[model samples]
Structure formats: structure tokens, C-alpha cells
Target: MFPASKQAIGMDLPAGMTLLLTLGVSGLILYLSIRTSWIWRHLPPGPTPLPLLGNIMEIGRSDVANSLKKFSDKYGEVFTIYLGSRPVVVVTGYKQVKEVYLDKADDFLGRGDLPAWNNFYKSQGVIFTDVLEWWRELRGFSISSLRDLGFGKSGTEDGIQEEAHCLVEELKKTKESFIDPQLCLRKAVCNINLSTMFGNRHEYEDKDLVVVLSCIQNTFAAANSSWVQEKANPNSVFTRSHLLSSALQIFFAGVETTSTTLYYSLLILLKYPDICAKFQKEIDHVIGPNRCSTIKDKSSMPYTEALIHEIHRFIDLLPLGVPRKTVREVTLKGYKIPQGINILPLLSSVLKDPTCFKYPAEFNPENFLNEKGEFQKNGAYMPFAAGKRNCLGEPMARMMLFLFLTTIFQNFDLKSSVPFEELDITPLVSGFGNLPRNYKCAFITR
Candidate 1:
């Protein structure tokens, strides 16, 4: 019914609408940019970031700890970086890390939301839970339970000693053949946790043990499922799922970090045989050849103790301690951080700080030794981290490291398959934790 001119004009309406939509999008982007600028203006300074992407390109494909060190050098110890659209404040150096985690512990006690962990835990478990009361109760219960189970007590040493013997027997089976020690070490370490937790240890060939290990390895993969459906129910505290989730967290944490540390210690010793000789001499003097080493012998074996501390320092295991969130607004180093800002207490930065250690980059046992050669504790040595939310398995892990290393070194002389120079001590994977590259070593019975 309309005229031909009107029909022609109606056809142009679609084009006009398209143009309006484009303008609206542009305005929205502009507003967002301004908002982002305003938000960042108050935070600590760091590298400039592109809108939406925000420093992802800068941090690409590099070890995050190393990358963060580079940023810390440029932006000072306290600086901010964007992980996608979210701003993460990185606190480096021992002074600053201690200030946030120790001095103002209560202010920085909240847990940051990690997508992968949230999918698995649904805000449950001591490691990832934000429920303050629940975290306190569970943490207390766990510590008490561990103590009751003879963790760090004389009663548990026999079990660890027995496991060490089992490990030695297994290694002896290798009979001088070049073998990658990863699987054996993993099993030994895992079995210790299993024995402690469930009062059962598995043989090397146990299919159930294999299945459990596989599940742990694939935890991040399985996290995306709807297994945490009970999270929505208000009355579901300490439910069956919660118990399993907590157990899984403890098992994974107890096994992976301890085993990886042992692996690194062996690799480092192989690289510096002179250091190894010194370590063995100290061990021989203190523990002798006939009997297994116990935790009580640690005081007399200062060099061996120093070597273990150096391995932890040199390896810089966790690198970035689990990300923390500000429970409320906090003022750190004169910079105001609002509630819910994700914080990374860069433990690697502190571990490698030149002010704290003589040779931060090199693997030196003297870092922990005084001029008199007695083991001196450094305040900066926080391999298990510090404060209220520090690693729950610290006592157990320390015991295992000392017992396992001393037992193995006492019974066998570790020899690398390749020349010392050919050995690669660099981490094969450096995300979440540092994992040493796989290599063959000969465990010759002494």
C-alpha cells in the first residue's frame, strides 16, 4: 500500500539499525576501558596491559615464577598484574611476604577462587575452602588426627623406616641397570601417605594403587564434572563428598610435593658429587652403615640437614604459594587493596632474594650453614610457606624427606648414567610446581 519511495526508504532502515548497533558496541567498550583505567589507577604499578586480554601475551608460555621475577625487578617488590580481566597483586621479597602472611595474617586469610579447584572442591576442603569456621575446624581436626596417628612422633618412624627398606629392596631389584627413579619414588612416597591415612600400604603391582594414582594425576581433568552438586545444599557440611574431597586433597598434596622434592634432591646431588660426598660423610658419621636413620639424628647431621634445606631453596618448589584473597580491605606497603583482590605471595622471589642468601641462584649448602658449620635457620626459608594457612603436612613431609634420603644414601651410592655436565637439573614442567626432567641413575648397593 506504500509508495515506491517509502518502500525504498524502508530497505535502508536495516542499514541504519546496523550502524546504531555498531555505535552502541563502541560506546560500551569505551565505558569499560575507562572503568578499567579507574580500577587500576589505585592499585600498585606494573606493566601496561591491553583491554580484555590484559598481560596474557606478556606471561605467555614461560615459567610463571620466572616471569613474575622479571616483573618484580621492573615494578618493585609489590606490583600488580592482570590475569585476564582480573587483577592479581604479587608480593615479592621476604620482608613483604612476611608482612602480608605473618604480620597481617588475619587480613589475608581468605582463599581466592580457582576455577579448576572450585570445580573439584565446591568451596570445601581445607586447602581451597573459604568458609572460615569450616576451615578452622577441619584444619584443627586434621592436625590432631595426624598427631594421633603418630605423625611426627616416634611411633610412626618405624613405619617410615619399613617403607624406606621396601624402597631400597625395590631399587636393589634394578641391579645396576640405568633406571628412571620417578615411578619408584612416586610409589614409595604415595604409599607413606596411604599407610598414614588409611592404615594400608600397597605393593608396586597393586592394581587398586595404580587406579588411585591415575585418579590423582587426572584430578584437574575430572574437576569439570558436576560431581560437586551437593554444594548448593545448605545442610551439606562434612558430607560424604566433602570427606572424599578433603581426603583427595590431602593425598595429592602429601604425595606430589614430597616426591617431587626428593626427585630434585637426588638430581642436585648427582650434579654436585662433591656436595654429595660431604653429605654422605656427615651421614656416615651420624647414622653409620648398620642401622636406619631416625629424626633424632638430625641434630648431629648438620651438613645433611643443610643439604636438604639447600635442595628446597634451590628448587623453589611451590614458587607462588597458593593464591590468597583479602578478607576485607587492606593497606599493604601504602597501597590500598580492596576486598576480594587476588594476591600471590611469591615464595620463589623470597627464596631467591639476594638479600637473604649468599648465592640465591646456585645450589649451595652453605646458605643454611653458619661459619662454624652448624645448621643455621634462615627466616626466609619458607619452603612449606608460613602463617596460619601454611602447609598442613609440613611435619610429615620433613620427616619423610630426612628418613627417605638418609636411608637411600646410607644403603647405596647414587651414580648418574651420563656425565655430570650432561645431566639436566632444570625442571621439565614448571607450572604449579617444579618437576625435574627424567634421567637414568644407577643405585649401586654399598
Candidate 2:
């Protein structure tokens, strides 16, 4: 190495100039970031923030839900908030949330696909783009594609039947007497996606596909973390384009959310064995023992339908709800909110609100049943979300859930290693999605 004294003295002027320039540039970036969109000018009341880090320092990992709950108590549902330089408007109450999602959906129908999302996926796809015109075009493509793959009526029932056969066979081969319903459900639900979109039934043994699917889970699981925001920014975690982020969004939203909901249906049934027995009796009398389950059978099975509705209502996967962004400046309740503010829909607050569902905490199918024991659709009971931006897969999802779940009950009993209450459905936060922490269950041969 060169002599320290000689090198230091020789490079003195250049080094000093470099140091001065770095300090000046840092000062400018800090000033610009603060001036841009700090909570002080735009965000509504909640918490004070520290410089550079914002209110991030005040938050602990496990304390998020509790923190949001506290804010809900104080701010009265829809309130302005912040995450870093971004301004956020948190809408907690269902009435307020329904307004944004249903009543004024045109202005608030889309979410800002953070730079990370656009870079990774290019975001040309339906889910990432906030534009209504674009979403319709893409949704039309997706629905039509699914219909062609047999998604509606009994058209997609053929795919489900073939996949269900594979699912039962896989369970038989494992024959462990105990298995994680998580993996089995993934195989079943994912196969449905594959037989339709990826053009073949995804195998249980395709480790690469499993890895990709696991990555999708891992990414969505990061919902509570800042990485979701970070990755949403351009060229950060996964890619410099929205392509990866968009693909990721579609996969997880498509897979895990629905998969967990299906798993809950089984869990709820097993815990209330009497209810399960009653449902089985209904199915036996109607759909019968010899024939496979189908969407055609759904109309005849009221109890089964009610149970599915109850599951969606009680087991809400998105606790923070799907965050949306305003297309432009708007005012609600005398609050002058500007465009691009992050919006949290408080779907959990809505679904769990006692006013909406009697004895909301407890699992009761009657909430979805009428005085006559007929299946009733609760407009307030929206798990796949609501409004113009409601889940595009709603129609197909309905068909698949009825068929697949019935197929399982017809063939086997879904048992957990422990009692259903013993299994925790309390969500673990991922980037922007909430997932069941543990979904271990067994397939009891009928």
C-alpha cells in the first residue's frame, strides 16, 4: 500500500471537495423528500413522525393490528394517515369503506402500483392497473379465457372433476393418516389454475412450480412489512419493471387467498361435526352418493352454500383490506383529500362488525340463512371485495368452491391434527396479504 501520510496529503483538495459535494447532495435529497409528501401537510391525524424514518420507529412488528385498532377507536373509521413520504387515508368502518368501494368506486377503484409493482410486472395486466377502461378489457380476457377452460356452469366442472380425481388420488398415495391441508389444498386449487391458465394440471411433484408458488406466498406474506412498498418502487427487490410484481400479484391473489378460504370451509365443518353431518345428509339426499359434485348441485344444497358464505364472512384474509388510491382530489365528510392518497378499506372491520353480522365472532351459518333456512346473499358480506373493482373471478370462484368442497365431503372427511379451534387462522402479515399461520389437517377416509 502507498504511504498513508503521502497519499492523504497528495489527495487532500480532491477528497475535501468530494466530501463537500456529498454533504450538499444529501442535504438536497432530504429537503426534497420532506417537502414532497410528508404527513404534516396532507396526511390526517394519527401519529407523529420522526425525520427521515417517519412514524416507522413507533411501530413494532406484532403491534400493527393493535396499533390500527387503536387508531380506529380514536379516528372514527375513515382518517388520513401516512407511510413514509406517502399520504394514506385509512377507512375503517364498513359504511365509510362501502362508500369508497361501492358508492364512489369510480374515483377510488384503483390502487397505486408502487414503482416496484410496475417495474416487476410492467403492470399492463388487469389487477395492477387502476384505470377502469383497462381493467374491463383485461378482465374480459381473463373471464373468457377461464370460460373456455370450463370455468362457468359445468364447462369448468370437467376441469374440476379431473383435478379432484387427482387430488383424491394424491391424498390416497400419501396415506400418512395426517397431512397439512395447506399443501393438499394448494395442489387442488393450483391445479385448477394450471389446467386453465398454464395449460396443464400442475403436478404435486413439480418442485420448481412449488418453489415459484412458495415465492408467491412469501411475497404476499410480506404485506405487513415495508418491503411491499419498497418492492413496489421501481427496480428494487425483484425487478426494475412491473412485470414480476404484476405476475406475483395475480398468482398470490388467485391462489393463497382463495386456497385459505377453502381450507377454512373444511376446518369449520369438522369442528361442528353435527353441522357437517347435516350437510352431508343434505348432499346425500340431493347430489347423492354416486354422482360427482357440480355447480348444478349448488342450488339444491342450501346448507352447504350458507356455510361457504359464513366462511367468507368470518375468515377474512385481508385484515388491512385491499389498499386503493384516489384517481384525483376528492372531499368526503368535509375532509379535502387529494389524489394518490393510499386507501385502506377496513374490510375486516366491516366483516367482523357486530352490526353487520349478529354474534360476529362466533361461526354461525344462520347469519347467511333466512327464517326459512334458504341461502341468502348478504350484500354486506363481501370477502372478495366490492364495487367496480370487485374480484373479477367472482363467478368462476363461486362455481369452483361449490364443486371442489362438495367433492371433498363426498369423498373424505377433512380433519385437523388438533381441533379446528386449536388451528390458528389468525393471519400472518406478508407484503400486502394476510395468510393462515398454520393449516395442518388430515383427510379421513370415508
Candidate 3:
């Protein structure tokens, strides 16, 4: 019906052909770009993630502490890595970490909020809230209440003395080392925290207490440094993501860290017989025979006080510590890290900074004591962290540590099954907090 040229032209699909051509070209470009692997190119170089799964696949189910340490060794202090599309910036060493924690403290005040937390944690816990102003206010209130409840003074020391007696009694029940020392320490310290927090002393065998502690412990394994690393968002604290992180954060951060710290201190003291002897002699000389170590005696026993400080510094609990998010976009080390980038303050690294401490690797109390034999405070010795967000339970933890140590030593001669080096200082690969490996010792009656 049409002319020969017109009929032939009609066969050429103009619009459809052009659309098809454009789509084809775009698809090719996207495929090339994705296949190019830009994470390696743009991100800080370290572990190369496989497609889809990321570094998580390669690392398997390793504890957060060991994996990060491994990465730190390969990458310089502030290398960036990815976990399932999430960007993680690792900051090792004292100087770089201090900059983020202290210098840009204002910017790095927020906690991380992650997806799994919201899905699971019910997300109303105090620590996970995204509101900084409210958080500081509440944290301050809680700390004040805790202080009023006998935290740093002789008021709480009385409670600690009672708990230590129970611990010694519990150990006496186990003549031979057949028990999980974990259970003993956990039960003992758990009771102390319960009494301190709620003014109730539930029996050690209380099923409810065990269940609650277990819930917190299991949650800690899942939601520790990795959660902080993942959330890394100050605003998220208001959201469910951070609520879960914060709720679980407090229980684990407070009880487990403090308790494990005590466990290690005991282990170290038990292993170093000569050190224990020196500590005991100092305590005896300072506070007379038979009187348990009290908060009042802290000034008199400078060596004992230094010993406790040294234990905290040397154990270096929580290698990665807590990850602090930038509240505002700030310039750090000439790099403009946009708000919400993960900033880790290696509190342990600072505690062991070579320039700050005499023997970075060795356990020495002299680092804490000066020529006048007074307890010298250094910025580097930050177990509770530093600045406005320093640990709320610091006063409580210090009091408990001192009282617990003094009580146990006052009653028994502690000894470890393994030698000092042989004893496992290696934390269980859980998260930032280095949980002590399972080991045992005898609590010989003094």
C-alpha cells in the first residue's frame, strides 16, 4: 500500500532501537564500574573483601580484639576497612587515638546504632539512646546517685569486705580445682554489683540472677566493639539501633569489664609471688596487721595504690575500648571526617605508650608513683577513658577494685596454676573488652 522506500523505512524501529541502545550502553558501564572493585582503590588498604559477604567472610568467627590487632599490624594506625557495606576506620597508637578521644571529644560523643540491635534488643535501654544532651544529663544523675550510695569512700568498702569473705568461703568449698573459676568470680562480683545497684543481695545460686547475668553476657558477645564499630552514629542513639547498643553496652561495659579486670589483677598478682609479697607487706606496714585494706588506707599504702593502678594499666582491658562517633563534622589530623565516621580510642594503647610509661611491656607500679611516693596522675593512664564521657561507674569501679583486692589478700595467699608468662593474659576473642582466658589458682588460707 506504500511506496517501496517508505515501506523499507517503516521496518527501522527508531524509538525502540534508540531506547534499547541507551540501556545497553548504561548496563555495560555499570557492570564495568562494579567489577572494577573500588573499595580497594578508594578505601584504606588492608583486608580485601570478597563479593557480597565482605571481610566478615574471610575472618570467620574470630573475636573482635584479635582480628583488629591483626589488621592493626598490617595496616597503619588509622586504616579503613569495610564490613558488609559499612565503613570502619581503625585508629591504633596513642597519638592518633588521643586526638579523636580528647582533641575532638565534642565531635566524637555519639554511640553507634546498628540494624541487628533494633531487631533484637527491644531498644529502650539507656545507653543506646541517640540524644547526647539527655544522655549526659542522665549519666550525670546516675553517677551522682551511685556516689551517694557509697562508691569511693569507706561506705562501699564495708560491702566489699562482706563480698570478699563470701568469695574466700566459696573457694574453700572447692578444695581441688575442679570448678570453673569463672563461675566463682562471676557469682561473687555479680552479687556485689546487684547489691550496689539495687540494694539487694540475691543469693549466689539465685536462678533469676544467673539468667539476667547470662542474658547480659550473651548480649555482650554479640554486641560489643563490633556493635559500636557498626553503629558509629551519634544521632542513631535516639533510634532503636543505638538503644539496643546502649542498653547492652552498660551491663557488659560495667559488670564484665570491671569483673574481668579484677580477675586478671588477681591472676597477675597470684603469678608474681614476689610482687604479691611486696604488696602485702606494704599493706601491712601501711594499715597495721589484720585490718583489711580500706579506702582510708589508700594514701598510706602508696605502693598498694600504685599496684592497683598498674594492674589496670598493664592488663589494658578493652583493647579497642568503646568506639566514639563524631557528633559534629570536625577536622582531625588534617582530615575532615564527616559526622558518624567510626573513631576508636585505644585506651590500652595510651596506657602503654612508650613515651608515657617507663616499661611499656613490663608490669611496673613505679610508673604510677613519683619521687615523693604520691600517686601521680597521668593522662595516659585512662582505664575509665577521659573527658566529659569518662566512665560513669569509675568511682564505684575503683572502690570495688581496691576493696575486693585488699579483702582477698587480707584473708588468703593467692597463687596461680601457671607461671606469670604461662598464665593466659590473652583475652577471650569476644570484643573490645579482653575477657581473661579460663585459668585457675589456689586460695591458700593465710
* Best TM-score among the predictions, by candidate number: 1
Collision count for each candidate, in order: 0, 31, 12
Q: Cα deviation in Å at residue 276, candidate 2?
A: 2.9
Rank all candidate structures by their lDDT, best first, as comma-separated numbers.
1, 3, 2
Better of 1 and 3 by TM-score: 1
What's the lDDT for candidate 1?
Answer: 0.85
Per-residue lDDT of candidate 3, residues 1-446 (tens digit): 85669756766778789799889988876665476355234444567654445577655354665566678778766666566656566676777777766776778788655456445554345554455775775566456656776666565677888887787777777774534566667777777766765576666667876776878645444433333432545644344344344545655566787788888887777667788998888766776556666788888888888898899888877666766667777765555556676666666667777888888788888898899878887768788877767776777788778877877777667667766668766555656466667777877766
Give me the displacement of residue 84 in model 3, in angstroms. 2.1
Each prediction's RMSD to truth = 5.5, 7.9, 9.8
Query: What is the lDDT, from 0 to 100, of the residue 143 in candidate 3?
Result: 61
What is the C-alpha lDDT profile of model 1 across 193-287, one tens digit per residue?
87876678899878866676777635433542443446766775555455556667877998989998998889898999999999888888888
Query: Model 2, 357: alpha-carbon shift in Å?
Result: 0.7
Give the winner by TM-score: 1 or 2.
Answer: 1
What's the TM for model 2?
0.79
Error of 1 at 87 (Å): 1.1
Over 1-446, each residue of candidate 2 has an lDDT whose tens digit, in order, gives 85679777867678789899889989987786667545336455666544456566554555354466677788767665556655567777667878888888887866664666567545556677665565665566555645665656564678888887777788877574776677777767876765565566667888755765666545334431432344554633322222334444556566776777777677667677787887888888887776887776778888888888887777776666667888877776557677777787777778777777766788788888888999987767877789877776777677777777777778777676787656655556533455546655667777
Error of 1 at 258 (Å): 0.7
